[model samples]
Target: MSFIRIGFPSLQQFCVNALVAVSLLVGGVAHAEGGPATAQDGERVIKLAAAADKDPLAVMSSAEGRWFQKWADDVSDYQFGPDKGVFWFHNGVAKGDLMRVLRFHHTVTTAAFQWQKKIKDPRLNPADDDAKTLAGVEGLLRAYEVLVAKNPENRVAKIDDLIAIRNKGGLADFVKAMPPMPSR
Candidate 1:
């Protein structure tokens, strides 16, 4: 599956921008007049987003959440269809599961971080590793989504297993081993 990606200097920058935009959009700070929004506004939003342990969209207004969902769909191949409810994470995995996964852990974050650090190097292809990692991340999300729907009773344990697989850098392997998720 093709993964949607945000064009930013780094995943960190993307998160900062997302938080800032969410804050402005939700707070009614970003108006046609340009308003009084300042760098500090973005900073406050960044702090809030950083500290959040659940999906970043959780705290946003419905409008803001819809905006974010569209943005994620446009940028990354991950689609949060309108019919599906919010709240992406399951029992055991919290803090940086989807986009956040690209930031923390021994997940693709490590590779993406390294790539971002060396972004200036001409030899490095920005899309190479990050794209694959993103696809893996999307796979992980899809797996969780299906497991929770199909086997609600074992969601906690399934999430634990997925987290373990992710931590061990086996996202693709784990996804490949799973039964196919039903098409939306």
Candidate 2:
């Protein structure tokens, strides 16, 4: 059998492309149409966040706009970075009217995302393992729904539950245990 030989440069490019594809898939940044993300795509998310009753502009400006820049770069490759753009996205799993939902969104964007990207501990870094980030996001989304179903006013309990679940490494199980979001 004859084997095909590839050059190092070709292999490196292939690896880079493969990594980009995998990251897009896992990062939830890929468009539904399977094309490279664009400024409009990022803008759409920002609009959705604004409609969700959260201040996208404010979040964009928070923490000296550090996280905001990273999130924008993730989706738009800095074509419209936080310095020049405001962006946010609600997955429609949580109600924006609920204070708990709003707070959770803020926490996820500012705190959770930071930890997931930076922390070495698996317990703190949801992105440490394959699919863990998705699981964590889904868990938080479901938790928002559960809290909305019960009481939207109390945010302390919501925060406590999040901390408890993260500490216990139970995000996937927590997602399974949550009641389904009511159909609109």
Off by over 4 Å in 2: 1-57, 60-155
- State the C-alpha lDDT per candidate: 0.37, 0.37
Model 2 steric clash total = 0
For candidate 2, the per-residue lDDT at 172 reads: 55
lDDT of 2 by residue, 15-97 (tens): 64445434433444334332344544444443333322222222332332333344444532222211000111233322334
Instruction: Write model 1 residue lDDT over 1-184, tens digit each, in one string.
Output: 3221212235674576567555646564422222332343333333333322233223232344343333333422122221101122322244333333322212222222223343222124535334434443553454444333433542455456666777789865654444433355
lDDT of 2 at 182: 36
All candidates: TM-score:
0.31, 0.28
Give the TM-score comparing model 2 with the true structure, all chains together.
0.28
